[model samples]
Target chain A: MATEITVGVGLIAIGASLAVGLTAVGTGMAEQAIGAAAVGAMAEKEELFGKGLIMTVIPESLVIFGLVVAILILNLVG
Target chain B: MLRPKQMLKLTIFGPKSYMKQVIEELYDMNAVHIEDYTKKSDDDVFDIGNPLSDNEKHSDTLVKIRSLISNLDIERKNILPRETSFETIEENVTKLHSKVSEVMAKKEYFTRIKEIYTKKEIKKALSSLRLRFDDEFDYTSAVYFIGFVNAEIAKLKEDVEKASKKNMTFDSHYNGVKAIAVFTDHKSKDDVEKVLEDYDFSPIDNPVVKEHFRDLTSAPGQRFVKLDHEVKAVSDKLKRVNDELSELKGENMIFLLSSEKKLTMEVEKGEAPLKFATTKNTFLLRGWVPRNKSKMLKKKVEDVSNSKVKMKFEVPGKHEEVPIEFDHPKMVEPFEAFMELYTLPSYKEIDPTFFMFLTFPIFFGFMLGDVGYGLVTLGLFLFLKMKMPGMKNFLNAFIIASISTIIFGMVFGEYFGFEFFPPAYGEHLVDSLPEHLINALHMHPMESHGALVYPFPHLFSRSHQISDLLSISVLFGIVHILIGLVVGFINIFENHGIVHALEEKGGWIMIMPLIVWLLLEPLGVITGHVYDMLASILPPLPVLGIMFAVGAILTIIGEGVVGVIEVMFLALMSNILSYARLMAVGLASLSLAAVVNDLSGQMIQSMGIIGIIPAAIIMILGHGINIALGILSPFLHSLRLHYVEFFGKFYGGGGKKYKSFGYSPK
Candidate 1:
């Protein structure tokens, strides 16, 4: 029983890291395409910078949510 | 704020001769937005003809002035025009053009003569050498070569002795470094040349010289001196011409600017007939004038054209497109920049700039809730505003948004993540903080007796209570989406009628709150406090099911049955959930600030007093990055929520903008 509990805690730690880290990768992947296109649009018309910036950052929330889940897993459990 | 200002369409008719005067007056007044007469046919009494010819003298003078202006490289300034008459300015410009051209022509002629004369003289001097290429020399027996070599005659003499087996005689001319002329018997010339090649010899072209040297004492080497002197003389003359042009430019700067402005206006005036409907004796002009400015416009037309102009006004049809003109208060006007980033609001639709103005700052401030960062941002805003006034609207949004950041930062009690707070709150971090930083950022972190006093209240902290923050974020999502739906409802109720609003926007408005309340059921059970609250006020799950059923029915009626599945289930649900991003972004900023403080605090403890240096450096660098991301991230997200999530509710903009047919000196 003690070993089972130890393994469970270990898995949870890995899960917390994986959760935030994987989501960061996902957000970065999403942003790569968006950022390139945004830069292209900005190059054509300088006024598009605001819209480009907004679109470029929209996927960042994915990682933020991931951080929340990671924080919960890291702190909330015994 | 919601609707565009009222507009009145006007028709102004005048005699063909008065057309130019009428256009000039309207342009000066700068009130009327012209509707070009291209839509009308020639068969109609008001058919517009081709524009009258531009003033020939005006165009020619403008061309000459422009050339002079560029040639002089005048620095353009918004200086007041000098009170010089058109005739006087024109005469001066003509004279300046002629003077510059004369100097330029002299320089050009000198350049041409220098190139040809130098070449001829070099050959003449070379022919005077009389070693070869003279009438006494026989071409069949020997060959003559003249060119520069890598080695001078002294160096070449040693190389020639070593490399050549041919019996060739050599003579060294006076310090001949560049000029090396070789003569050898035709039978052994190739062998002698092979040895010269070892010395890196390169032959200069011996063009056929028809004339001999003019002076017996002149050295062929001295030809470079003469050519260089000629080049310098021409360049000096060119510089003098440039100086004269610059002086003219300095004295006549304002006159040139004024002439350009006057000519451009005349051109626009002359072209007015192409836009208006004209006959042999009369011309008709049609345009939209703002209702408020119409009275002034009418009076100006009468005064400027000697009452030869006749004007009329009429209301446009309901379905017809009309140009939009916004009349926002000066303070709220900057939010128009946000509106323009997406699209302009449709003619009949309400402008959402005011709604965006209020919400955007709130979202931005909440996300970047820190005092030092906010003040820094506000400082940056002021700097940009001072530097680039033309970017007023864009910079003003940042200025206004920073105000919210300061307020939220104070509420959060976070000045660079509590570096300013007293060490008593967190005992582990106490040793890391420098003495001054504990009271820096204008807040002292000191304990009062046994009791603890916070610098400012934290209404809702981004750092603590992660789960509760998520819950609050969900709640915020519900409220925000509900507000969007309500705006949609109001928009539809006015533009589209109540029944459609009730079934479409109204259904979601009713359904969203109930769903949020129901979803919280599990959390309430675990928390106990919310369970009791839910048990006391809210009904069973069946009630939620019934409410959704009714809402789905209304959605079906309004947007057809497919909309319930696609829009209500997929789109609406996702949109409400998306508002959780607000909380997520705020937490990200909080986490970054806390990490910086924590790292710096810990590292400081390790180094003690000396640690303060690296710690301060780390804090500055970390916080600098944090501040840039803080400003741009929150600003962009706030704008995204408005453009993608909020404005998606009721607005679609394709309205033509109102542009007054007027001229100002650029």
Candidate 2:
């Protein structure tokens, strides 16, 4: 029972960190290509700066989603 | 505040001679949208007006002076334009033009010559360098490629000789590939060149001549040096001339702007005839003017043109769409930019700016409710407002939102997630603070030992009541969307009457309250026995069943069968779920704040006295990142919720904003 409790906590720790870390990695990957394209578009027509900004930050919510999942896991684990 | 300002369309007419005066008066009034006359008849009836008689001359002068102003990069402070006579302007511009052109021509000449002479000098030096080989004769069928060679020049020569299938002699000094220039026969040039490709042989810059470099360059070097001096002298002269022109521009900045406006006005007046329908003598000008300004325009025109110009107003046709302009309270005016960003509400549509103003900050604060962050943001906003007066609208929004955040922060009792007055002092802190302050602060979330208490009572604890917060967020979303539905229903009801309103918007309104009642027992819990008694009157499952049936029927009646059964249910549910972002984002930042504090606290413990600096640095960076995300997340999500969730309920926005002919500050 003690070993079970310890394993459960270890798994929870891994899961919580993985949730946030993997999502951040995904956000970074998505934003890299999108931000590149947005900047390229911005270079052509400067007025698209606002639209570019909106697009570039759209992936940011993904990290927040990950944070939410992490928080949920931590709540259960802690 | 709820509706766009009432707009009236007025069409006016006046005589040809007084048209310029009429236009001047109308533009000065700044309340008329000119309708360009479209050709409808055979006799050039809807022709555009000719520009002013001196428009061409004025415009020509304007272009020169405008370019001069831009080139100087001057920021003029004077509001009043200095009145300079046309004759003075003409004379000065002509003189300046000639002088500028002369200097520019000289500068271009010097730049070209300098580039040419610099290249010539490099080539002359290359040619002057002595080579040990034969110099006197030009080979009839062969070429000398006197270029730099690599250390493997001997192998390259063998490759060239083998590939060319001809006699080839290597004569070059070793400075690697840069110094190697091959001399091979014309018969074997292509083959030798092919061999050279692998060896990386590129000919030097001076490709035309192959002679003793010393013999070629000794005499011409002096001439190249002299050209360099001439370039330097001309460059200095050009800079002096450019400075003179720049100085002239600085002094004449006001004059230039005034001339530009004068010229543009003349152009508009001259072109007014095109919009005017003319017979032989009299001209008729027609356009829409605001109703309130119609009488004012009539009086102004009569006063200006001494009763020579006449004006009139008429009600537009039923189908004719009028331009829209919103009237909002000053405090709520900044959020109108958001309305403009999405789309302007059509003439009959309810202006959503006021609604957005009330809800945006609430949603923003709900997501980022932290006292330390709120104060910091508020201070930053105030500072920026002082620095940039023109950006007041943008800064004011954050100021208002930050105030909301501070209010919610006090409610949440979250100062960077540090437990200032832990649940141990929860009741003490609440009782100590003023009632309004206590009520505004939601301090139930702290989790210290002993009975958690609040003097004024908190709605819920964030740390302990995540599920409650999530449900509350959904409730808020429901209330907001329901209000939007009500407004939409009222708007449609006023415009298209009962059945249409029901079909268009009212069905959603009916569904909202029922969904809240049927979906949760917490609504009852939150409201005490009020919902309990209501549920007792109709039994829980039966009430849910009845509400669902009514809502479904109403929705089907309104949006057709498939829409109510599938589309409406799915979209509405997703929209409600979207509000979960509010709770999630809020907790994320708060948790991050706690993590930062934890890490720093750990550092301080681990390293003792020396760790304080690194701990502080980490604290600064971590919190800084969190704060940045704090501002950004709330702002964007609030906008997203507004633009998607609320507006999606019922808003058909695409109206032309009303613009009037007016004198704008330069």
Candidate 3:
């Protein structure tokens, strides 16, 4: 019997790729909306602009979530 | 804890009162009113019109005149005909004005006539007259000298005019009114009158008259007249004051106010509360004053209320001290603290914070179910919570989700989007694995040609199969509804009683699981070749009917027939569909990652190693972008499902938070 490659690598790779891809997409969309709102808010209230900008970037954690998955994929494949 | 308690109790007195004082100081102090101070009577007050800086000199002059008049004290004594009849004063003033006007007209005519005529002819005529009086005396100071000189000159002019008028044949009665020019030695009233009369020239010619004329023209004399005029003006004003004081007479002497009637009225009534009944012997009054003023105000209230009525002060908590108050009140502190882990947004009914915590990890783990991803997320949230104070909230929230993801990843049998668990810890955890299980569930992340799985797996390993998708969906559905039911029970029980919870939410709970289980079980009496596989699992016909009967009764008892119908229709549909999103998001993340890998893989192959580097970079970047999108999709969408689909079954919002005005930013 010709032994197949371990499906473990494939599952993890797919999972990680999904994790990274979905996270990046979700956060990017969220950031676009939130960033626009923050910029608008900043224009209105300059003092609160810094804080708003920071908070707008807060949802970017989704990207971090994706990056982690990508790193996991790299480690697993490597 | 110390800060939390302080947040709970608002300070009764402090900076707020000081702030009030600062405000008081900034604006006009006299403008604001204070209670308990009696306003003085304005009856005796003299209201000077708005005094400008220029009024300083005028005021000084007024003061000097006032002193001169007061020194005489005639007006104060009320001896100066106390009532100077306006009519008599008017008549005397009119007559005096006419006399002055007549004298002024005569002087103007003589002066102008002199300017018109020859100076030499006028001098010759004056000298001829002066030679008649005295060549030794100055012509300018002659007793009626100007009049005498003008008379001689006038006589000459009249003879000429008489000649001219006689020659022209006009009326001869135009010698102008016989007005005598006054030249007095004294400044006395009689001296001026005598000089004006045709008789009594002795008084006008007296040595005193000459001295008086000299005195009238002197600087001190002019100053004296000004002084007298000022004195008279001051005396007249003082008399007006006396008149006003008398006219201000009244029966009841209440304090007069210059401010608005309401505020001044409030001040006068001892700052009484709006609801106070003055008719009653004692009254109850309550109002908020600044914290700094609390002590002083309490003392004032005690003094006014005579210590009979009590005073209370309430100060609300500050944001930093009890930021949770910015959230909710009735929530138990620990729950509030837990909720605070997720922001307790003031506006939302459901604390989506908890929902975020519960759902984010599930979504994140499902999308990025690698042990490595979970660990990374966990570490990131933890570090953020520790290091960045501002991000501490987000960090804590994410950390909680990451932990959930880590746990869920283990259960899902996924590690880094892959199925590496069995190989990694095969002997220790799962003794065996299976054929259909690995292939269907495993997520391939490697770029290698192909991968296979070890055979013979346990039931848990088989839990994620495609056939079991419905069952998994049903299982999740039960959990979701149960959570909603639990929350409903908690909510109703908190507000109403347990009886309400049972009446409303209890029935659905009992009916849901029973219905699912009954449907899943086979219940067939047909004994045919095609039904052989399902027939073994079917309950006996008699028992099946009885089971149905019990379930029907329970469904009716737990939820009314209508409720049962609604729940069966709505809850089952919504709950099942809600789970669909989970699968959808999971698939979406997986598919996107797969596409990125495939695209980049093609690039790498076509371009060679150098080309592969760029392809690999693109893959990394593209996959990175997708991971971000994936993380949020599961997280927020899961929350949406929970908040809208689940929690709607059980939440009521609209509790008015307590707001105290004693301490505020103003």
Instruction: DockQ each candidate and list the results.
Output: 0.38, 0.13, 0.03
- Give stretches of model 3 more than 4 Å off: A1-78, B1-364, B375-391, B410-464, B467-470, B518-565, B598-608, B656-666
**Chain A TM-score relative to the true structure, per candidate:** 0.82, 0.85, 0.67
lDDT of 1 at B464: 48
Best model number under DockQ: 1
Q: Write the per-residue lDDT of candidate 2 for residues B25-123, one digit (tens) a residue.
A: 776787877666677767774455565577678778867866655655556443443466777877887677676665554445344434434455434
Better of 1 and 2 by lDDT: 1
For model 1, which pairs clash? B48-B277, B48-B278, B147-B204, B422-B445
RMSD of 3: 28.3
**Maximum-lDDT candidate:** 1
lDDT of 2: 0.68
Per-residue lDDT of model 3, residues B1-666, tens digit only = 101211222211122212223222312221111222122455523221122233344333333333323322223221212233333433433443344344444444344333323222322222222122234434354234232222333444444333222111111111231222332232233433332232211111233234334554563222211123323433454455444333322210111111112222222222222222222232222223334445665555345444544545556422222222333233222233333322333322334334444554565565444344567668766776777665555555566667766666566554434443333454333334454544454433222235434322222222234224324543465567677777777666755677766667665554554454443443211113313433454556666555545544554665677766765564554454355445445555555655666677688678777778877787778766765775566556555555455656665433233233221211
Local distance difference test values of all predictions, in order: 0.69, 0.68, 0.43
What fraction of the true interface does each of the listed models get right, in terms of native contacts kept? 0.46, 0.07, 0.00
